[model samples]
Structures are given as C-alpha cells and as structure tokens.
Target: MKSIKFTVILIFMMSLTTFHAQEVVVVDSTGVAQENNEVLTTSIVKDTIKVPFKRFKAEGVTAVVGDYVVLDSDIDKSYLELQQQGIGVEDITRCQLLGKLLEDKLYAHHAKQDSIVVSEAEITSQVDQQIQYMVSELGSEDKVAKYYRKDNIAELKTELYTVNRTLKLASEMQRAVIEKVEVTPEETSQFFYSIPEEDRPVFSAEVEVAQIVIEPEVNEEARQGVIERLNSIREDIVDNGSSFATKAVLYSKDGTAQKGGLIEGIQRNSPLAKEFKDQAFSLLEGEVSEPFETEFGFHILTVDKIRGQEVDVRHIILFPELSQDVIDAARAEIDDLREKIVNGEITFEEAAKKYSDETETKNNGGQLVNPVTGDTRFDLTKMDPTLSAQVYNLENGEVSKVYNDRDYTGKSKFKILTVTNKYDEHKADYAKDYEKIKALALKEKQIREIEIWQDKKIKETYVNVNEDYLDCDFSSNWIKK
Candidate 1:
C-alpha cells in the first residue's frame, strides 16, 4: 500500500517535470529508478496505478510556492489549474515558474529602492477605466467577463489586477535595463545598413519634443471653494447611502467623467503625476476619500478594490478656473514666438530654450518621438491630442492660430503651434531609416548580453534534481542526476 501511494504521487509529479528518456527500467546502469523506461508515462503505470484527472487540491505546496521551492507535481488540473485557465506552460520545470516568481520578487525590490507606492483610490480608478475599455472592446461587460473566463465582474477585475501588477513590474525591470544603455551614431548607422533592403522599415518623421507647461494662476479663494464642494460631496457619499458612481458621472469634469469617472487600469508604480497619484492612493475600498488638491484640480475618490496594492477607483475631478484673459495671454505669447521664427529672427531651438515652458524638450528643436518605435516622425494621431487635431489640418511648417491646450496641471492654457515637421510614407532608405534599424540591432545585442548573464546566474543558483531520470536530456544546464 505504501509503495502504491508513493508511485501514484511520483507519477503525478513526473507529468510536470520534463521526461528525458523513452525507456525506463526498475534500475538503470546509473542506479536511477525507472518504470518501463521505453514506455510513456501512461504505459509506465499500465496496471500498477490509475489516477483520475480532476481539479487538483494541493496536499502541502502553498507555502513553498511563496518561497520558490517548486513542487514536484502536476499543475494542470490541480495546484496551478494551468489547463483550466488556459495558461500555457513554456518550460514546466525550469523556466516559466522561476521567471514569474523572480518578476514578483524583483518588483518588490525596485518598489522599495525607488519608494514606488500605490493608493487604494488609484487602483479603483484604474479598474473602473479598464472595465470600460474591456466593455467597449468586447461589446459589453458581460462579454468581457466571458472572454476572460471569469464568472462575473469581480472575478474579472481580480484577474486584471493580477495581470497588471505583474506587467508593471516587468516594465520597471525593462526600464532599468534600458536606461543606461547608450547607442552611438556609428553603431546606429551600422545596424541600419545591416538590415536586408526588402525587410527595411520606413520610419515616420517624428519629432523629439520637450515642454515646461504652466497654468494661469488660480485665485486661492476659488480653489478653496472647489475643495469645499468636493468635501461635501464625499462626506455625503460616505455618511449616506448615495451612489458615488452616479455623482461622478454627473459632476466629474475630466475626460472620463461621463461614464462614472473611471480611468483605465492603473497598476501599482504607474508613471502618473506625483501629486494626483498620491491623493488617489490614500482611500479605502467603497469609501469616499477627503477632497484632495492636485495640479489638475480638486479630486474626491472612492476605491473599488485593492489587489496586491494595485487599486481601482472612481473619481470626480474639477479643474481650477482660469479666466479667458489668461488663455488669450498664453496664446499671444506663443504667436509672438512663432512670428519671430517665421521672420527668421530667432530659430525654433533658441525659442524653445529661451521661452518654451516645457522643460524636457526645449534644448533641442521641439521634436516628438513615436513611443512605439522611438522614431522622430509620427502619424498625425501620435501628436498631443488637441495639437494633433489642429495640426492635421495644416501643411508642414505652417503655424496655427491661437488655440488652447490643457496643461499637465489641469489648467487651460493657449498656444500657437506649428506644423514644424513632416514625413511622407516611403520605402526604407539607409539614410532615413538608420536610427530605426540601429535600435532593433541594439535590442538583439542586449538579448545576447542577458543570456550570458542568465547562464552565470543559473550556475550559481542552488538546484537539485530527482534521483531518477538523470540521464534524460534537459533544456537547462542546472539539472543533472
């Protein structure tokens, strides 16, 4: 009876572990145990044991997963339910589990080192927004839940939070890896020239841009009044049974205000503005937070959930009042700058350095990058939304009439923008597409660097293997009998 139970458990464990040999023996020359080595797992236990495939219950593996000690057992129908979730396994034993576990640990480490933190309201806000997008794309909320294999909205949100948190960590890791990497013009040219002509790409003529935006000053009294209004709304929601979502839809003034003030999924450590994010993160689920001020305006929030510190929330935002006079003033100043450029009295780069408020991009001529490919040319849609709509109407190098843009601070400001650059969609040329090819080549080079690093890390990592099937060909270097 003892041997039979042992065999059953062993067989289950082996289904997850990579099987290296076709044949099995009671004992091979290396003294490794095998069951009809030449036979598959099913045939190995032909008559000795029969295990039913059903929903798995872990006998003792919960705590071990948290610590990264992988259980030697099936994950498909049982402990992991990978099959149930349709989560494909890459390397059942060696890579997938360890990669996922490492990503979790690394996110924690970076969050601490960088003081990255999240608030409940922020996550709630994110969840609400994601729900909207998913609803739109899938035709309805119910369909989204069905597509995700969730029984309802709550479960679908739970899965989204889990996926988003991991993705945020991965982004942080990639950013860390890429930040210090530098490419020279020579290297760029070399990479560009190396691509086969037929496979070369035509990069959009995108500009790399930077700006320091400032909002017209708001009266302190008016700002305070807005705060008081938000405080009263929040207090009413908390103390009474009033629905926060209903009020948000009616009163919120942000882009997403119409549909219950939900923004898209906001993961922990998301790169949103500092002040607003802080205010968003401080609330608890289903609880209305106190009115908080960000550059955007007075914000009141209600958190929907908190999953691993990534939250989803709904918020009502009211921007501070900027008089029409201030808007005209900003537009006039930008027009003066454009006139100087049109007259050739001052160059765009000089104007950016001397007067353009956007801090990051002024030093060079105002250029924008395609985030998807880091290219200078962009499709019209890639431009700052208000700017994009306006610029698409003008030919290249034309300056626009005075118009308003909502500054990052959430205050309305006006500007006279130029269709400063343009590119035609054409076949890739080494001269025009060099930078694009260079980046791709550099990424491949970095992957090679990572592999070398991985080889060393795995060798030093303490690993052990089952005493049976040691001679089977394994994918990773760490496993030997």
Candidate 2:
C-alpha cells in the first residue's frame, strides 16, 4: 500500500479558556519478503524440495475504536499538514494526538449508530469554503494545490469532502449535547463573583460618539453607467458560461471577493436591506439576479445553494463613482449643518434627525452602537479608524470638523462626529459589566456541559490506543484496554 498521512485539529476559543487538540496518523507501505529454499540435490536425486513463502507485513494500527483503525501514516500526514498551516507540533504529545483520534473515531461511530446524516451539498459548499480560505491564506490557488499535493482545486475538494462531512457531523453531535444547557442568573452572578479581584479584567477607556452622515449623491449619468456595467456582466455570465465566481473575484468591491464573492450562511430574515434580501431570496439555485439597487449599491448575485432559511450566494457589487463636485456639495451641506449646531440654531440631535442619510442611526438621533456589546459604548481604540482619528482630542459635547470617510459598504460619506460620553479605564464591576460577565458565564457553562457529555460518551464507547503512546500525556481517556 502507498503511504498516506492525515491530520486533524479542533480548536475552541473562549475568554480565559481555550482547547486545542491535534491528531496525526502515518501509514507505512506494506513490505513483501521472499525466501528461497536450497536442497542437497546430490544426496536426494528423486526428492523435490518444497519452498515456503512469506506474505507481506502490513502496517500496524495507530489507533482503534470499535471497528475503526487509524494508521500511523495518517497521523504523520496530519502532522505535516498542520505544520504547513503553521501549527506547532513540538507542544503536542503523541498521547494527546492519540486521544484526539480516539475521540474522533468515537464520535464518528456514535454518529453512524445514531443515523446522523449530512447533506452532500453542505459538504460540497464547506469544502469550497475551506479551499477558498486556504487559497487566501497561502496566497494563491497554485500554492494551495502544491501544498496539498493536488493537481488543482477540484482534486483538493474531492479529497476533503469526506473529511469535511465527518467534522460537520461531529460538530452537530456536539451541539446536540449542549443545546439545552442554560445558565441561571444566580449561576452567572456567582461565576462572576468567583473571579478574584486581581484576576479581574481591566476595562479600556471608552467613548460613545454620534454622527450625521451624508453620502454624496452620484449624478444620473454615473448611476446609469454603473447599472449598465452590472447588466453587461450579468449578460456575459448567462450567455457565455462565464464563471460568476471568477468574475466576482476580479470585479467585486466587497471584502468577500477574496472568497469568490460567497456570502455563506446568511439568514433570509437577516437585517440586510429589504430590497437586497427580497431579491437574494427570490433567485433559484444557480440563478443569477439582474442588477438591483440597495442602500449599498447596485448588486448582481447568483444563488449557490439554500438550506432552509439560510442562503449561500456569490455576488458582484458595483458602486456609483461620484465626482468631486458631488462630494463638495455633500461636504458643504454637512458644514452648514455643523455650523447650525455649533451656533445653537439647531441641536446636534435635531440636525442629525433631519439630515443624516444613514437610516439606522438617523432614527436614533445618530447615536453609535457597539456591534459587539450591543451598547452605545466603544473602547476608543476599537472605534473606526477615521472616526477615532477625527474625535481623538474632541472633548465631550464638542463637534468635529466635517470630514470625508467611507461607510461600512465602502461608500464615501461626509460626517461631523461628536463625542457624547467618555469613560475612563477601570476594573470590571458587577453593575457596569453585567452583560459581559453573563456572557462569559454562559460560555463557561456550555464548555462544562460539553465536557460532561464527552466524558459520558467516552465511558460508553469502545476506545483503544497503542502501547507506544501510553507514556505520553493525554487530556482524555483513550486507553481503555
């Protein structure tokens, strides 16, 4: 048999706690030996000597769980792949690897016994995403192919499909084990109090700022030009068998272009613009949408697949190019509004309500919310680069000078920011940091629940590890002889 290597690593990250495990299996090629028997032909002329033959010696199993056997070469291959991905092998003990392998086998065994099924489309999509991620990380598809010893992306996808499907099933099983876990308010509070004072995390200096953003309006000609370009691209895709994904990589302005314009696992009821969502969900699989306008820009999308309410799609987005005159007009308007606010002719909130083009913030009087914490507070260091630089020295209630910046979608806008509130760095407190503490507590509880489930499953499953790995330090029980 030809030797092959495989490696698997599962990582879980939580605040103050993380788990990392790696499994490697290396298989050795089978070897055949032949022995020839020589008889004393001079002494026995009538007798013929019979020779016995020996069969090839097969490679030893690296790990075993029930009917599953992990070969050594698979382990070695896994380690090599992990090294290519920049994961260090020096710290991972052989026993740890063996334990992880046993755990994976156990999960796979149980998954099969439970009749857990993963769809082919899901596996294909996940493989594509994994390939895209590796390509991006390794700098190019050719590099990825070389690293994986594959001829191309298609061969790599075929190789990884089974692995991706197994991992998905394991993840689903883990979620099932922990889905019903809940942390009560008392438990959360207690978990918070258990942290020693000196060990408590320190909060960073934070600021709450508000803004009135005014996007420069493109001229009719510019808008029509963008729309026509998108239409032509769409036509090329439909008529010429041109790859929408390849075109998206070349032409899409969005950050996901590196991923072939794929936006994975977006819910149908997501907070995306209504027009965009409607058009996105209305397309059939492999169907491309015509040019459609949203708050961001004109977009053309092809639905790759849909699972329930979640959709995966590739899109090409084009934004209308604005001229200096259009931008100057927006700047002048924002400057006028800022002057009115500074002169007390209109309150900052009132001006924002009346003129801000951004609907999410305008209705709320332009108050900025931290997407992470879902609050109107942000660590000054965490603020948008442009906004932070503009408001760095501005005192509370001070209005910044008008400045041009791009919004989340990379659309140019002019804005005047005001630092409404600032909080000095301090130690975490039960009152101010309740939400943060509760989230940490919930994560801890989930981790604990998963651990408990894992322990129980290990006891119920058949696990066996080679004696060679017995002396290595292992994090789990995989040596049940």
Q: Candidate 2: list runs displaced more than 4 Å.
A: 1-10, 14-61, 64-126, 129-146, 150-153, 218-225, 228-290, 299-317, 343-347, 380-394, 407-410
Which segments of candidate 1 are over 4 A away from where they belong?
1-225, 234-249, 255-270, 277-292, 300-315, 323-398, 405-412, 419-434, 446-481
The prediction achieving the highest lDDT against the true structure is 2
TM-score for all models, in order of appearance: 0.49, 0.68
Q: How well is each residue in 121-183 modelled by candidate 1, as lDDT tens digits?
A: 444545566677667766987776665546777876775564344334434543454456677
lDDT of 2 by residue, 279-385 (tens): 77899999999898887788999999888877888899989887889988998899889998999899888888999998889988899989878988888877778
- Clashes within 3 Å, all models in order: 33, 18
lDDT of 2: 0.69
* C-alpha root-mean-square deviation, each candidate: 13.6, 12.2
